[model samples]
Target: MLFRQFFDAESSTYTYLLASGRGREAVIIDPVKEQAQQYLTAIEQMDLKLVRAIDTHTHADHITALGDLRAATQCVTLMGEFTQAECVSDHVREDDIVDVDGIRLRALYTPGHTNESFSFVLQPERPEAVFTGDVLLIRGTGRTDFQGGDPHRSWDSITNKLFRLPEETIVWPAHDYKGWTASSIAEEKAHNPRLAGKTEAEYVDIMNNLNLPDPKMMDIAVPANLACGRG
Candidate 1:
């Protein structure tokens, strides 16, 4: 499998692209609207066919380039069971396999950060990795105190769903606020401050401590992303 990762330092967001060596197909995940050309250029450089674009969940920070991707490429779009999903060709479900070119991604409906948030695993018929989105991160996990979020459920998603993966399974999150990236189930199990062997009530308490404000760009970004970047 071929993979490319890019970071938008301003929003602390990371977008990724994956393709098969055959280069006959490719997909973009968690793309940022402002960084659309970066993906296009990468596709052009790799000589791959852009077949699909997806987001693990509706973004609350910067708008995504999904709209732009649709208008620019003949690619199918996806998101996880979103009531307000923008241009999603598939309301991805747990265990649903998303095939693009020669690569396949399996959706894991590990909600908690939001009802529709998901983590996807890329299994290219070999050793593979997972894109954990906001559900799980390197040393940190996504806040479950925001809109449509729940801390107790987040605890289940983390300790049960995510930790169930093999210890060697690598993780790449949607945003890295700590300049952090990459982790294994073992690493997160041992080191994740908020999730390490904590009780459900304790987890809830910790989550409640995170009094985060709403994303500054949600109103503008959500609709723009849903519309595929309407002018």
Candidate 2:
């Protein structure tokens, strides 16, 4: 498979592009509006056709490129079935397979960071990697203080859903701040300070007491994202 990971420094967000190979159909996940042209350039250079753009959930930290990409490429915009982003052209329910030129992504409803959050497993038949959109991070987890976020649900989603993937499965989270690019399921299960060796109750306590401030762009980003970034 051909895979590319892009970073938007402003929001500490990560966008992903995947295709079976050059000139094949491709899909993008969690794209940032400011970086749309960058992605388009890469897609054009690779001779790939952009067919789908997906957001795991409505974002509060950065505007999405979904609408822009669709306008430019005529690709379908997608989100999880529970999302309120009505502008999305399609919604994938749990276990729904998105097949693009032999590259497949199986949607997994692992809501926690936000009630509509989802994680897409790549090559689901063998489970090579998972695009965990903010629910599971490298050595950290998304704060569960708003947007229908719940500490208990986050714990359940990570422990019961994500942890069940193969130990070697690559974890590609939506954002990372510490310069870490990727992690394996085994590494997170063993070393994640918040989840590793901690009881559910303890995990909940930690998340509840985080007292983190809301994202600087939440007020603007949330409303804009609902319109597929055109608001």
What is the C-alpha RMSD, rounded to one decimal, of candidate 2?
Answer: 0.5
Tell me the tens digit of each residue's lDDT in model 1 across 42-139: 89888888888888887778888887887788788788875376467767888888887658888888888877788888882442688988888888
In model 2, the runs with Cα more than 4 Å from the true position are none
**Residue 186 displacement in candidate 2 (angstroms):** 0.2
* Per-model root-mean-square deviation over C-alphas: 1.7, 0.5
Worst 10-residue lDDT window, candidate 2:
103-112
lDDT on C-alpha atoms for all candidate structures? 0.81, 0.96
